[model samples]
Target: MDQKLTLNGNPITLTGYNINGNNYFMLRDIGRAVGFSVAWNGSTRTVEIDTARPYEEEQPADSVAPTDGSRYVPQVGDTIRCPDGTDYTITDVSRWDKNAFVSGPLGELPQPTCDWSSFPEIELPAAEVRHFQLESGEYLFIRNLYETRRMQYTLQNLAGNHPDTSKDGKLAYGGKGSPAVSIKLSIPSEISAYSFWPWRESEIENLFHSCPPGTYYMEAWDVYKDGVFQRTEYNIRAV
Candidate 1:
């Protein structure tokens, strides 16, 4: 028996055999053809299929909310776009109450007055990274990565010893604390070309802030349907 296989309208070459006038595909070959993981557990006699990628879950704008007890607390300088398409940049934030103050075309207004937070939910634009020069003849990389998982991000010098370790001595996700860390740079959603300080106020608590000059590992995880699917890694140098 002969049949054509297509994935997303694209032809896929699969290693299959015809048995009793029926087509049977090799488990590993089928998994490889579709970018899936095909593994057998001898003890359990079960196979695990990880369909993490190529099937991204789409989330509605209103569904982007901080989970329960999430460490991602909105800080000063975070920008938010309301449902009405009104964009506001947080100019000032109260350290005590954690309220943000915003400025717009009219003028600067209190956090509540802007009504940006009053909306059911707001969105952070795509994360980005930019570099700028200082009076000291030094360049700094400003990470505009947001706390949301809508897009991916990379960073360096933040990987620490964890309780979770794989057979190869690699740090896995599960541990006593969150494997992911929050970035707190004052960088805005959009960086300007001529602005001396393109990024917002520098955050002292961010691990990248005042980090020693060295090479660091950067990683970003992909989220699907509000669940973390997988993570990617990169290397960045801080000078």
Candidate 2:
């Protein structure tokens, strides 16, 4: 038997007949659809719902063991390996929209522009500019909500990299277009502006490939933390 159900905002439309109007749902399909581990407890005539990751208590120790994504609380010095593979230390953690918001700062800063003659006297508040890193070992430049892949050269750092920010390690375009990430750039050369570029997501195969492969138009706010960045709005792309 099948039935319609909504789980975690996902519409699970099932098809099944109701017997005698007694709609005791079938456990198997529904359980798998909603990512639940289900087993019949024959002794109790009950269906045990794990409601979380399945466990193999009797399984032997092996590298093939399964591990579902676990929401771990991150501390300033806690290092976590995300699914993407880069290592980061959680510098801060906050809750926004009922989800974990994490910030990662590289333990170090981006490479300096190394040139300063065209630099301006950065007149904005210090908080107007911040840096963050993604699980791909790439960094972002942000000020409030506006951020870009490029930052004007400063004695400290230059350019927060974004998805389409560089396909050849250079910005072919700036300040407009679809992007996986966005950052506002400001610097001494009067190059201060807003830039939107894609952030690297999914499998990153070529570090020097300019833009990541398989990155679509989908944009997502992320919770990120690294030794170089801290906790802040890794948020929903505003509508």
Candidate 3:
């Protein structure tokens, strides 16, 4: 049987045999397809396999094709897009360095690292409002912007005040932490991007404990240099 195989976006062919209604593939064919080594030891009368060694064709050296330079090799700081439509920046390329190779036919290779945290900082056209749901079942509002030293935020219930029977008939207020609360944060003189979480997870959970399900308004201002830098608002739903 002829089998069509696609490895790393490249197509190849392999021969397989049907045995007892199951397709069986040769070990040598599988190793060559996956770039591994498979050899038979006549002296020991056993089969030897080496995963560290790459598969080498027995063809003449002249048959090896030269690189056309059309393929792009990723280096440190180079951003590449994955097939899944996600962009990732190369953080390290030490694995490709000649110094990483050992004195052996098959040298150990180091794996490169690509971290999302190491990606370049995002540049926003304006202040952005972000939300995170806490494990305590409360939403934490985050204000992301540039050049921020102080953050002032307010949460207002748009559905007005009401009594929450779930919390001992407590009178739920429209403005949970109103008049507006402000918090001071330290900003380095060299850094500008800032992300501020208005309230702690526990505090947010407590604030909404007695509040009923309704639409709420969240307004936040990024204050720096003794004035407001940017203001953003978001409509939140509570249940």
Q: Highest lDDT, which number?
A: 3
* Order of models, best lDDT first: 3, 2, 1
TM-scores for every predicted model: 0.21, 0.19, 0.23
lDDT of 3 at 149: 13
Better of 1 and 3 by TM-score: 3
Kindly list the per-residue Cα lDDT of model 1 for residues 1-239, writing each as its tens digit.
34579999998777668889888987667666677666554235366677774322223233222333133333444434333332223333333222133232112211221222211222344443322234643222212233222111212111222222211222233355432333322323343211211112222114344552222222221111111111111122222
Model 3 error, position 213 (Å): 99
Provide the RMSD of all predictions against the true structure, rounded to 1 decimal: 22.4, 17.7, 23.2
lDDT of each: 0.32, 0.34, 0.35
* TM-score result, candidate 3: 0.23
Q: What is the model-wide C-alpha lDDT for candidate 3?
A: 0.35
Q: How would you encode candidate 2's per-residue C-alpha lDDT over 1-239 as one tens digit per residue?
A: 65667787877876676778766655666676666677654235365778776633322212211122122233445444433332334444443223232233222223543323222233322322223444665443223322211121211122123343333333323345443222222233323222232222211212223333212111112334233333223211211
Could you tell which candidate, 2 or 3, scores higher by TM-score? 3
